[model samples]
Target: MNTFLFSLKVMGIGLIGIFSVTVVLIIAMVILTRLFPVSAEKQDEESK
Candidate 1:
């Protein structure tokens, strides 16, 4: 019983760690995409 409880605790911690990493990566990707947006073809043609 004790071993089962320990395994459960470990699994819970592992899940939380994974969730935090995923959230951080998603936030970073969003910030980067906003900072470097793609130009439209019309703008490119006008600039040339």
Candidate 2:
């Protein structure tokens, strides 16, 4: 029972760490996209 509880604790910590990192990365991407938006010309060319 002790070992099971320890394993669960470790897994929970690991999951939380992964979720935090993913959220940070997503936020960074959103900021970067806003700071460097695509040009109208580029959009037009891609549409063709």
TM-score leader: 1
- Model 2, 1-48: lDDT tens per residue? 999999999999999999999999999999988876788558878999
- For all candidates, the clash counts are 0, 0
Would you list the clashing residue pairs of candidate 2?
Answer: none
Give the alpha-carbon lDDT of every model: 0.90, 0.92
Please provide TM-scores, in order, for all candidate models, with all chains considered together: 0.70, 0.69
Q: After aligning candidate 1 to the native by TM-score, how far in Å is the CA of 30 from where it should be?
A: 0.3
> For model 1, what is the alpha-carbon lDDT of residue 11?
100
Question: Which digits, one per residue and each the tens of the lDDT, describe model 1 over residues 1-48?
Answer: 999999999999999999999999999999988776676555777899
**Ten residues in sequence with the least summed lDDT for candidate 1:** 35-44
lDDT of 2: 0.92
